[model samples]
Target: MIVLAILTGVLTGILSGLLGIGGGAIFVVAAVFFLGVPQHAAQAAAIAAMIPTAIVGVVKHHRNRLIDYRYLPYLAAGIILGGMVGAYVANITADIVLRRLFSAFFALMSIQMFWSSFRQGRKAPAKQQDHDKH
Candidate 1:
């Protein structure tokens, strides 16, 4: 059990680095699927796990000139309010329903990512034409 948890964390870290996306979803999925944690608890755990991972991600990306912090205030404000409401709703929702909803959301995201990968892969390189040819 401990090994599985560590393995999930390592993989989530690698994925977060490669994709530049937060690791919360992966953590939540691993908690629910592998660790047998309830949906609400898994979500709360994911939020807890986000702190260190987020700090590391932000620092690394900022060092590489990738971060634009101007939007942080607005985004953070919305997330804070939304998260409170989300948590309240999740707490009142049944575990089975929450599990189903999580599964459906994950599946949809996976399908969208798979389709987007293929679409992006098939794009031809833009050809540079000689503008001086008159």
Candidate 2:
């Protein structure tokens, strides 16, 4: 179990670095398949793990002046509301239902992303804009 956890963590870190994602998918899938954790617990754990990661990323982005701080309050408000609704739904739903839902959602997202990339490869490049107009 410990070995599986460590492997999952390592895979999550590698995927995060390579894909610029926070690895919540990795955590959720690992918890479900490997650790036998329920979907609600997996989701909660993924969110908890993301907090520190988001903090670090935000700090780094802030140091580089890459953040728009003024919009944070609005984003935070929406996130809080969504989190509440998600938790409520999770509370009422069966574990298998949540797991299946997450799995389906993830699979759809992957398929859509793959389709997007495939379509992108078939598109012709647009003409470059001349930016030095006087």
- Please, what is the TM-score per model? 0.81, 0.86
Across 61-124, the per-residue lDDT of candidate 2 in tens digits comes to 9999999989999999999999999889988999889888888988999999999987875663
Candidate 2 is scored at a TM of 0.86
Model 2 residue pairs with clashes = none
Instruction: For each candidate in the order shown, give its overall lDDT on alpha carbons.
Output: 0.84, 0.86
Give the alpha carbon lDDT tens digit for every residue of 69-116 in model 1: 899899999999999999899899999999898889878998999999
Instruction: Score candidate 1 by lDDT.
Output: 0.84
Q: List clashing residue pairs in candidate 1.
A: none
Worst lDDT run of 10 residues, candidate 1, spans 125-134
Per-candidate clashes, comma-separated: 0, 0
